[model samples]
Every structure is written in C-alpha cells, then in structure tokens.
Target: MTDSQDFSNLSNRRRMTALILLTLTVFAIGTAELLPMGLLLPIATETKVSISTTGMLVTGYALGVVIGGPVLSALAGRLPRKTVLSVFLLVFIIGSIVCTAAPSYGLLLAGRVISSLAHGTLFGMIVVTAKNLAQPGKEGKSIALVGSGLTVSVILGAPLGTLLGQHLGWRFPFLVISLLSAAALLGIMKQLPPLPRSKGGSLKGQLRIVSRPDFLLVLLITIFGTGGTFAGFTYITPILERITGFSSDSVTIILLVFGAGSLLGNIAGGSLADKRLVPTLFGGLILLAVSMAVFTWSSHSKAAAVISVFIWGVAAYSIIPALNMLVLNKAGDAQELASTLNISAFNLGNAIGAFIGGLVIDSTLGLAAVPWVASVVTLLGIVLAIWSVILEKNRKCDRLPEYPFENRTA
Candidate 1:
C-alpha cells in the first residue's frame, strides 16, 4: 500500500477515536441531565421539600439550557472548538461537584442550573465538530453516532446512576457524573485535534439567519415534534401504571424495552437521514403520529401497550438526526449558532409538552387523553414539515434560469 493510503487510514482511525470520546462525554452529560428524575423522591425527602418542588430541578435545568445555550455559544464565538469543549466540560465537572456537596434544595437547584448552562452549547459544538470530522457525505451518521450517547444514557447510564443513587444516595450519582466529566475532559484534551471555529459571521448576522422563515420553520418543526413526544412521555410512568395496570417492576422492564426501541430508532434514523434527508423527516413524523395515536387505544391492554410504547420510542427518536441536519443545512454559515438555537428549541419543546400534558391530566380529558393530544401535536408538526418542503422546492425552482425560447413562446 502507498504511504499516503496508510496515513489516510490512520487519520480515519484517529477521527473515530475522537468521536468515541465525544460520544462518551455526551453519555456522561446525558446521564447527569436525567438522573434527577429517578432520585426525586429521595432528594425531596432529604431536603425537606415537597416532591413537586423537587421536580423544579428538572425544570430549572431545562430553562437554563434554553437561556444559556445561545448566550454561551455567542460568548465562545471565536474560541477554538477544542478549547470551548474542554472549558465546557470543566464547567460541567464543577456543576456536578457542586451538586454532590450542596446541603440544601436551593443549592442543589442552583448546581443543576449551572450544569445545564453547559448542556446546550456542549451539544451544539459536539454536533458541529462531529459533522466536520465525518467522512464526506456521512455527516448525518456522525451526528447520529454522537447523539446515540443520549439514547444509551437513557438505556444504560441514567438507569445505572439511579440504581447507584438508590443504594448510595442521590449525591452519589452527581459525584459519579463529576468523575466521568473529568475523565472525558482529559480524554478530549489529549485525543481530540484542535478544531477551528465555525465561520458564523457576526452575532447579529447569525440572528438574522436564525430569524429567516425557512430556519424558523425548521425550529417550529423541532419544537412541535419534540413537544409531541414529551407530551406523553413525561407522564408515561403514570400512564403505564394507571392505564396499563403494570406493577412497578413491570414498569421498569417496560421502560427498558422503550430504551431498546430508542437505540434501534437512533441507528435507523441516522442511517436513513444520511441517504434521504427530507423523506426521513416526513416518515419519522408520520410514524410518530401514528404510534401515539395507536398508543391511546393500546394503553388499555398490557401486550398492546408494550408494543405501542416500543413503537412510540422508535418513532419519537427517529426524527432527531433529520431535524438536526435541517438546521445545519438551513443555517448556512451560521451553523453553530443555528445548531445552538435548535438545542434550545428542543428544550423549549420539552417544557411545552410537559406543561400541556399536565393540563390534560388535570382537565376532564384526564390521563387517558394524553396520547391523542400528543398525536395531534405531532400532526401539526407534519403540517409544518409539508410547508417547509414546499418552500424548499419553490426555492430550488426559483434558482433555475429562465429559458429565453420558452419565455418568448409563452
């Protein structure tokens, strides 16, 4: 083999290694993000706060991500990607450490917010960096691969942390996250190459791109699609318990099944997005709506509920890569800022879905109606997706040169 060919192979190997480290970093971060949910009761008891108040930890973190993502991305505008990643990981480590040592609920909430401030920007940069390092035409796959960490966290990391927290204490989970973050930080500094900053023009220019109708439409789709999923998901445990009449242990097993579905969905979505971006988006949303709709009726039966839940998991996560790719494609030079904004859009969707779900539960429609509501929300996203596609086609056609003979004849 030629020496150049050998060097090319080595370079690919290095990139894969770096990608793996980034994925691991995201796993740690994702685990930290969701860990509080399982430990809420224990944390509430220890901190002398009501369980509802304890739930604020999750809310606060999501709010922090929405508010802090773009702000931090703007602040780090000109910094090297490697430097920004390392700094963000350091901030995450510090926040996790704070959570580990906090003596009161307020302090714990503050630590969660601190950790969350790193979440959006970290994910944005990771997505951008992964795209850059990917082999040609494989950007979608790389993003999916990096994002798989979050799915895996749902599947493995968060559950393991919850188990550890149950045995050791709520603080122990945070402590483990801190250690993981530190290790990831060290790996990043050593294994990752120095990446250049995105050419995301001025902050004002980036904002202009973000405000464009096409981009806004993409964000809307993200918001509605994610919101639709979370609308039912936020209350899935209750739905499983009350409607499906599953035991606590059975619920746990059911969730594992859901996680397995998520992992499979992530892989399938990423692969398909790499090949057919727009179609993947449309199909994913369609499947998501259908799954949620089916879930409404399926919830009454144990076997059917489990089947619907698994399909719901698959449908829910499948659109992520397509949505992310849409942001990158639509944002042009402002990809980094756009990517960060998309992250915020996702978090905003989560808050909206949970809020709407809560409202549905309180109203006469009650818990049984959550799935249908979620299905409707997803259907709205499909409408936006259709509009976006039409606009895209028009834009493409507009770029075509007018034929002089055709114009003369017509």
Candidate 2:
C-alpha cells in the first residue's frame, strides 16, 4: 500500500485535476506513437519508400522506447519527479518537431526515434504518479484513467490525425501532435503537484528483478498478450480496405468505433481491476481471445466487422490495469523497476507484433489471416496467465509458516 499520508495530503479536486493532466500527457504521446499506423500509406508514398519500409518506422519507435526507458530512469534517479517529467515532455517536443520538418525518410525515421525516447519513461512515471494520487483503494481506477488517455487518443486524436493526413500530408499530423504536446506540457506544469522520487533504484537492483520467475512470467504474458493486440491492430487500415471492402475514408470512422470501445474497456478494466484484480484479468484475456477469433471471420460482413472491432477494442485495453497491478504486486519492493520494465516490454511486444504482422502480410496468409494469428497468440497467452495464477498460489502456500501439527506427515 502507498503511504496513507501521500493520499491524504491532496484535496479530491486537485487529485482529479492531476489525473486529467497526466492522461492528457498520455494522449499526446499515444497519438504521436500510433500516428504512423493511420498514416502508413501516405508516408510510404511521399517518402518514396515501400510500405514494408514504412512499417519499420513503427518497429524503430518501439525499439527506441525499450532502449530509452531504463537509461532515462537510471539517469534521473532521485531527481524531482516534476523535473524529470518536464524533461521527457521536452524530448517529445523536440522529436515531434524533427519528425514534422524532416526532408526525407531517414530524417523522418530519426525524428520518430527521438520522439519515442520519451514514451516508456513517461508512461511508467505517469502511472506511478496516478496511482499515488488516487485515494488508497482507487489506484486501479487512476491507472485506468491514464489508460483511457492513451485509448482516447486512438478514439479521437489518431483518427483525426489520419483524417488530416489524408487531406494535407503525413507531416501535418506530426505537426498537430506537436501542438498537442505543447498544450499537454503546459497543463502538466500547471496542474501536477511535485511527486515523490522513487527510492531503492540501481542498475543491479533493477536487473535482479528478472531472477523472480513470477515477474518474468508476467512480462512474458505482456509480450504475447498485448503483442497479439498489436498484431491485428497495427495493420488495421489495410485489413479494413482489403478484406472488409471499406473505403479509406470509412476506415477513419471505424477507427472511432474502435477507439470508443477502447475508452469503455479502459474504464471497465480499471474499475473492475480495482474491484477484483484476478477475475478482471482472466476475463479480459478470455474476452480478447474470443473477440480476435470472431474478428477473423466477421471481417467479411460490414456490420459484423464493426461489432468485432468494437469488441476487440474493449477486450484489448481492458487488460492493462490488471496486468500492471499484477506485476506491481509480484515485484514486491521493486515497484518502479517492475513498472519501467513492463513499459519497455510493451514496446518490445509491439516490435514483435508488427514484425509478425508484416510476415503474415508478405506470406500467403495475407491481411485476412492477421486476426487469426492474433487470436492464436492471445489464446496462448491465456494459458500463461492461468499458469501464473497457479504459480502465485503455490508460492504463497510455500511461504506459509509451519505449525506444530500441520503437514507433519508431509
């Protein structure tokens, strides 16, 4: 549990404001992060690169997040949380600027990498900050609020950016995100209180977390489960066009439906995870598997496609808060370490998902098979999730103190 004093010090209104501000930060970053997915075609056309090459930009950003997260956290150790956050926002701003103004594919890719350097650290820090701001038991809700920020960007920002890119050019979307990032920075500075610096951090201390099989298994769940979501989602625009027979313009609107589902799912996941962590997690996995499998076949029908996408949206993001809580609990004293690693693992998963999705596209499987592959990957993740739960129970049983008569024969 967080120190009660931390939760008690702030007024409810201020805490809510902090949550809104943190969520906006996520929105700005999330929009920029995913903008490539919606604008993939335009970027490839204008940059004179193949679509496959454009896909690598997404992979590059993921790699940047994985690399930047730990290094930034280590460098900022014991620093003021607000100052560190400000620094990250500045890095994001610079990256967006570079991306927007780049003259060629190489420069655009460079800019994307710069912008992504802030992602992992920002997500990890904001989540920790949001949890601290919540009133004790509402930690999951606060984390979910942050998740909603990211999801809402998909709902609103990414699609809007996509719409804008279709009209003006891909560069324009990055420009719009740059403006959003500036507003988010101002809001975060004005609203967010000084948060406590995390303690007990060191490279050695961080690396030592992998020794815990429970923590490692949870990360594996993250890679495969969330990776499965990315497998279907990262290539969504193409899937809608080639299989569902939707026009590009219609794809934009459908993305909104997907985004709405994400918003609802984020809230439900947060609320339910706070209420009951284990059940919410298991249920979310089950929901994701079913949705992906259905989406594979449902792509043939326009109405069914919409329903499948909405369900996919809900099932996809709903697992985040529960998963984060699970990892935090399993990590014990190394909360920050676990949080940052999980953040990096998410992008690592993204890179893997994108790569796998690309292979499916290039192979005979084509776009129609993406959801099926995603479903299979996610179903496997469910098996790991169940194993983790059983492992946790066994670990707890092992830790029980021996009594005089209990287990005497054993």
Candidate 3:
C-alpha cells in the first residue's frame, strides 16, 4: 500500500482504541463525581450535617471543576492533548485515593475539590479528541459515544457504588472510584494516540469570547440545560427514599433506570445533532421541561416516577453532546478554549442546581417541589434556545458568520 493508505489504516485503528479508552476514562470520572449522591444519607450521618449541608460538597466539587477546567486547559495549551489527558486522569486517581483515605469531612471535601480540578479539563480534551477521530458528519455521534461512559456510569456506576457504600461504609465508593480511575489511566496509556500540541489565542483572547453574543447565549443554554437536570438529580436520593419509599438498597435500581434512559438519550442526541443541530437541541429542551414537570406528580407514584426518571434522563443528557457541538460551532477560530469554557459552564450550572435544590429542600416546599422548579427553569431554557435561533437567523441575514464549525476540524 502507498504511504497515505497505510497512514489511513493506522489512524483508524488508533482512533478506535482512543474511543474505547476515552469511554473508560469517562466511566471512572462519572463514578467519582456521582458516587456522593448515592451515599449522601450515609455521608450526612457520618459527618453530623444535614443533607443540605452535605450538598455543599457537590457545589464545591463543581466549583472546582469550573475553576480548574479553563485554567488547566489554558496552562496546558502548549502540551500534547493526549499527554495532558493522561496527567489529568492521574490527578483524578490521586484525588480519589485521598478521598477514600480521608478521616474527616473536611479532608474528604478537599479531596473532592482535587478530583474536580481534573474533571473539566479531561472532558474538554476528550471531546476535542473525539471530534478529531470522527469521520465527516460524525462529530456529534463521536462525542456522544465518548460521553456515553459518563451516562453509563450514572446508570451503572453510581448505583453499584452507592449500594456498596451503603452496605459497607460510605468511603467504599471513593475506593472504587480510585481503582476505576487507575484502570482508566492504564487504558489511556495503552490506547490513546500521540496528539499534537494545542494552538490557540492567548488566555485573554479566548476569555474575550465571554462577551460575544452567540457565546453568551450558548453559555446560558449550558447553564440552564444542565442546571435543570441537577435541580432534580442532586436531590434524587432523598426524593426516592422519602417519596417513592425506596430503601437505600433499592435506590440503586431506580438510578439504574434513570441512567439507562440517559445513556439512550446521549446516543440519540448525538446522532440527531449530526443530522440537524438546532432542532435536536430544541426538542431535547422541550422534553426536559415536560419531564421535569411530570416528575413533581410522578414522585408520588412509584411506577410513574420510574417511568419519569427514564424520560428525565433522556432530556437531561441529550443536550450535553448537542451543547458542546453548538458552542464549538459558534466559537470559530477558538474552538479548544471555547470547548473547555463550555465544560466549565456546564459545571457552573451543576453548582447552581445543587445550591438551588438545597435551598428549596431546606425551605417548606419539600423535596417533591424541586422538580417543579426544575421544570420552570427548563422552560426558561427553551426561551433562550428560541432567542438563539432568532439571533442566528438575523445574524445570517446580515451576512455574519455562523455555523463556524461547518468547515472547522479538531
């Protein structure tokens, strides 16, 4: 074979391996990030705090992710993306071990922050890599597949970790997370191809996009879209225990149902976005709003709630791959920086949702009220989406550049 054809074959093999490694890495991160939710009750009891106070740990971790994501991406701007990803996974492993060994709540909190610092940067790098690996018109699907590790973790990891923690000790989840992260590190070392160094505008230049109208609108969508999911999910364990009357052991099963729905949604969203980006986002947001609204009533009926969780999963995660695609598409020349910042935006939304969910629960509204509020926020997100569409149309009519990713590649 000619040199070009040989290179093509090598590239295909390498990309496939990278995809599997990325998926495994995502699984590890997902378990670590979400394990706390399942163990919230035990954590609260052990730490001598209310669930709401313990919820701050969630907010704290997300805050760390937001802070760490862009800063790390910017700092690592000169390094190979693959190398940076490997280091970040190593950081995650260390953090997980620290969390597992922590003797106090404060130490555990610190460990969570450490792990979170790796979360956003790792996700940003993975998404970019997945985009590069994709064939033409397959970027969305590729991102979704890499991202599926997270959804599967939510469906499979959290429940199992939670069950193990509840049955053993609360720290067991962290130990499992640590092991998983180590495993991911091994896969990454074995499979990921050597990546070129990042090339982009200075940190200041990239940050300038914060003021751009299109970027801001998409950032808002990320905030609201992700925040809506957290508002319900952050408080999910309590809601299941109190409302659905599921025991600690049984909560895992319900979460599995939710995860299953989310995994399916993640795949569907990617494929659909590959075909038509805007319409898929619009539909996903609408479905999210409807499902969040139904969750309020569904919480009172186990059967309905189970079904609702499935739909809620779909709506919540479907927007993720779509949002990442949309932001990169809009950012034009600054795709990597924009992509990393979008991950930060998503984490910021997570922080917002957890805080809001806590405030609602601490108030007289009770746990069931959380989903209703989430539904309203999701409706507001729909407005943002519509506005974005309108703005894009006007911009296009005025001869502005849009769909910047149309000709863009990683």
Candidate 4:
C-alpha cells in the first residue's frame, strides 16, 4: 500500500474513534439529565419533599439550560473545543456526585441545576464538532450518529436507571451516572484530537445572527414542532391507562415501542436531511400532524393506538437533525451560540406544551382533547415551515447549494 493511502486510512479510523467517544459522552449526559424523572418518587420521599417540589428538579434543570447555555458558550468560545468538552464532562461528574451525597432537597436541586448548566453548551459543541469531522456529504449522518446516543438514553438508560433505583436506591442511579461520566471523560481526553478554538465573534455580531429573519424562523419552527409533540406526550401515561384501557405493564411495552420508533426516526431523518433538508422537515411535520390527528380516534382501539403511537414517535423525533443542520447553516460563525439557543428553544417548547396540556386536562376539554390540540400546534409549525420554504425559493437561498437536492421545489 502507498504511504499516503495508509495515512488516510489511519485518519479515517481516528475520526471514527473520536465520534464514538463523543456519542458515549452524549449518552452519559442524556442519562444523567433524565434520571430524575424515573426516580422522582423515591427521591422525594428520601429528601423529605413533596412530589410537586420533586418535580421542580426538572423545572430547575430546564431553566438552567436556558439561562446558562448562552453565557457558557460565549465565555468558552475562545477555548479549544476539546478543553471545553472535557471541562463540561467534569462539571457533570461533580454535579452527579453532589446529587448522590446531598442530605437535603435543596442541595439535590442545587446539584441538578449545576449539572444542567453544561447540558445545552455540551450539546451545541458536540453537534458542531461532529459536523466539522464529517465527510463533505455526510454531515447530517454524523450529527445523527451522536444524536442516536440521546435517543438510546431514552430507550435504555432511563429505564435501566429506574430499575436500579427500584432495586437498590435512587442514589445508586446518580452514582452510576457519575461513573459513566468519568469513563466518558477519560475516553474524550485520551482518544479525541485537539480541536481549534472558535473564531471569536463580537457579542453584537452573535446577537445579529440570532436576530436574523431566517434564523428566527427556524427557531420558531423548533419551538412549535417540539411543543406539539410534548403536548400529548406529557399525558401519554394517563391516556394509555384511562382511554386505551391498558394495564400498567402494557403501557411500559407501548412506550418501548415508541422509543424504538424514535431511534429509527432519528436515523432516517439524518440520511434524508443530507439529501433534502427542506423536504425532510416538511415531511416530518406533516407526518407528525397526521399521526397525532389519527391518534385522537385511534386511542379507542388497543391495536390502533400502538400503531399510531409508533408513528407519532417517528414523526416527533425525525425533524431534529434537519433543524440542527438548519441552525448551523444559518448561524455563520456563531454556530455554537445558535445551537445552544436552539436547545433552550426546545426546552421552552417542552415547558409550554406541558403547561398547555395541563390546562386542557384541568378544563372541560379533558385528556381526549389533547391530540387535537397537539395537531393544531403542529399545524402552526407546518405553516411556518411552508412560509420559510417560499421565502427561501424567492431569495434563491444558499441552502440550495449546500444540500444539492434542495434546489428543486422543497
């Protein structure tokens, strides 16, 4: 073999190894973020807090992500990417340890918020890093490769944590997460090559990118799309029990089905987005809307409910890769900040959707009406997506050349 060819092969192998470590880091991070939900009852009991107060763990984490992401991203902007990622992992490990040892509810909440400060920034950096490492035409797939870690966390990590908490104790899960984070940190430090510092853009310049018409529109699409899914999803357990007449065990199996569908959707979305960004976004939203609408009636039948739930999972997660790519494409040199803001946007949408769902359930509209509300919210996203596509076509947007296939009617 030629010397240059051997070097090229080695480079590819190293890149793949780095991507795998990043994916593992993401998985550990995701599991830590979601562990509280599965162990909420045990945590509340042990900490001597009400269940509602225990729920604040999630709320506090979300607030931290929104308020801290931009500040941290900007502050770390000039640091080497590897350094920033490693530091984030260390922060996560420390926070997890704090949670495991906290003697009071307030301390536990503090640990959660501290850990959450790394969530948005880490995701933003990881997405951008993966994109930079990707082969020219495989950017979407690379992003997907990292994103699958998060999806797998939902499917496997959280459930396993819950089981561990049930068998051992709630504290055990946090301890496990800390160990996982430590392992990921070691892998990142050893295997990942040094990445260059970001080109420092002025605060005003970063703000300008955030305020751009196209960029703002993409963020809005993310908000509405994510909100629509969580609207019904937040109430899924009750819906399955009361409306679908399923046993508790059956609900677990159905949720597993949903998670499996999300994994598939994440993969398919990335591959298609590489070829056609606009079309993939549109198709995902349309599918999401239709599935939620169908679910309104389908919930009456067990078999139909399971099928619709799977479709809902697929449609809900399928837009993520495309949306992340869109943010990077539009953010110019401020990709990290833009990506961080997008994560905040998603959490904002989650809060909004859950709030709206709660209001609907408390009112006369009730649980049965949630799917219809979800459909309507998703339809608004569809409208915005359509408007964005038209604007792109009229302006002959640069996205066309980026995706190659997007030059055709999206």
Query: TM-scores of all models?
Result: 0.93, 0.88, 0.87, 0.94
TM-score of 4: 0.94
Work out candidate 1's RMSD over C-alphas: 5.1
lDDT of 1 by residue, 1-410 (tens): 31112224448779899899999998998999999988999999999999999999998999899999999998887787889999988998899999999999989998999999999999998988887778766777888899999999988998899999999999998998999889889999998877777553787877787888888998999999999999989899999999989998899999999898888888889888878888888899999999999999999999999999999999888999889987887776676778999999999998999899999999999999999999999999999989987777676579832111111111
Q: Specify the poorest-scoring 10-residue window by lDDT in model 1.
A: 401-410
Worst 10 residues of 3 by lDDT: 1-10
2 or 4: which has the higher TM-score?
A: 4
lDDT of 3 by residue, 1-410 (tens): 21112224446677777788888888888778888876888998988888988887777887888888888877876576768888988988888888889877888899999899999888888887787677767889989999999888877777789789989998888887788778878877877666664355565766676558778898999998898888878889899899888888778788888888888899999998898888889889999999989889888888898899999998888988889898877865456667878889887888788778889998999787999998887787889988887887777679875454353221
The numbered model that scores best in lDDT is 1
How many clashing residue pairs, candidate 4?
0
Runs in model 4 deviating more than 4 A are: 1-10, 397-410
TM-score of 2: 0.88
Model 2 misplaced regions, further than 4 Å:
1-4, 40-55, 166-169, 201-203, 237-239, 361-366, 400-410
lDDT of each prediction vs. the true structure? 0.87, 0.82, 0.82, 0.86
Backbone clash pairs for candidate 3 read none
Number of clashing pairs per prediction, in order:
0, 0, 0, 0
Measured over all alpha carbons after superposition, the RMSD of each candidate to the real structure, in angstroms, is 5.1, 4.6, 3.9, 3.6
